[model samples]
Target: MYVGIDHSTTGIKVAAIGDDGELTTAFRIDRRNVETAGAFLEVLDDRIGLSRVSLATVTYAFGNAIDEIEGIEDVPNRGTTDLVGLDYGTGAGATVFDRLYDSAVPTVVLPGVHRGLDTLHAFFRHYSALAGADKVASMRYALERFRAEFDASGAFIWVCASSSCMAGLVCGGRLTGFFHWVGPVHGWPDPEAVRRGVESDFEDVFMRCGLLPRRGADLTDVHDIADRDLLQSVYWSTLMNVYALYPFARDLGADGLDAVVLSGRLMRRERPFPLGRRVYEACVDLAPVRFAEPYTSAQGAALVARDVAAGADEVLGIPVGDVPGGRDR
Candidate 1:
């Protein structure tokens, strides 16, 4: 079996995939509940049968320190350049990374999309970072989803709308650009938010500047917000973010998007309003839009582990590294 670990904003998610590429087990652990790596491993063993894992692919925060998929031991600073504003709860991600490094399971870490990556278009180098490693994993799944469902492989955009909104473009089968959450328009921050971040603290600004938070909505219970007006605002904001990516996609030489894959916690919610369907309808005119499962990132990571163990050299344009004992699989 192959395993994938996603250290997300609210929790640590693990997904195990059998040799046939079928999902066998999946679970999420609250960051607050797992203070130590031992605690995390114990929970993982209980839920996914750790002893049976052949290879485990893990994603931590930022992932800007490296540009290739590398073994856990080969990465520096746990695959990050800095930890600013990443101390979610109990620093569980750090604990999980450290423990996985010393564990018996062969593990590899993924890099985030950033200026340092040579695969991206030169225009995207204006920003320092685009998305995290989990986003790359998500893009991997989106690529497969696009090919499997839409039967096209030209180009596509993956839009993730959750606590924050961001989009990535895959053109010519390579990750070429991204619409990051830090941008001024339709992203997490507006001019007002930038001013507020300057006044108070910019560390946590990204988490506090989304459309929901800007409208004074509670993020902890985002799915529970009953205000139709607020939901409409969020729906339109997400649509606008998607709309903003079309020109960029075309500029990168994509005739047009083969499809647009939508994923994230918000895209899966149905309460108060059918936000996911609304967003999909808004974009159906542009291209085929598909909803991805919530476990997409982890599942994609599992696929990565499987392919790397099978001696594949690259995944979705991201180069693979020599994973010490991985080829033995």
Candidate 2:
């Protein structure tokens, strides 16, 4: 058995997979969670019998200076360096790396693609950095379940989650360039702006512009778009895509791409404000288009972990690190 751990925006999730490709109850903890290694091992001992586990894979922010996972230190916070860099000082996922390492089990830490390391694939590195290691886990899981229905081969995906919208490419049997649109501090703007416009004292000006939030809890109604808030997502998304595309394209390659995929909470909203449609419309004029499954990162990370334990070369076209000590050098 092997364990794949996803360090997500919301929690630290670990999944145990059997040799036959079965997934047991995946365990998770809040980003702020801190526990002694012994206590954590006890929990794993009771739930899935960690003693039988042969390998563990985890993705989280060790630090901006963390070129390889070996230099990662156990800071007293969550992966807040990015957030704190942006002035959102909660330090949520920092302790995760320490706690997991304390288990003293054989483990592999995935590198966040960064130009600092002089990585050949820095573009994908940044996006995965934003999504963290967990999203990779989720995407792998989602791909395994939906592979028959979608053509994920030689494709790039754009995902929108709670705080940001991210885009990535899978090619050559490895995760390529991934870019984070939202900065360390501000995050994604359209959602927060829409929420603020909903509750602002400037309702008169907003109403004059026919802007408002979803009425009475029903987001699918025409009123949703008629209101200024949702209507504005169209403009905001357009601006975001325009700015995001350049960096994204640079990561993919100068020759261009085969297809584009869009997925995220905002994209899944009842009111389709033409963000994906616009991106597709814009990109389709230049290339082909594809849609990705929601919640793919979490699923993908888990599947990647399973494959890593089996010594596989690629998971859904995303190249993974070899064994626990394979990349240690």
Reference-based lDDT, residue 320, model 1:
85
RMSD per candidate (Å) reads: 3.1, 8.7
lDDT string, candidate 1, 45-146, tens digits: 888777898888998877999988899989999888876544342377878888899888789998898888888878888877777898888888777655
* TM-score, prediction 2: 0.58
Among these predictions, the greatest lDDT belongs to 1
Report lDDT (Cα) of residue 55, candidate 2: 69
Q: Per-candidate TM vs. native?
A: 0.88, 0.58
- lDDT against the true structure, per candidate, is 0.77, 0.47
Candidate 2, which segments miss by more than 4 Å at Cα? 20-22, 31-43, 62-92, 116-131, 135-153, 183-268, 271-295, 312-329
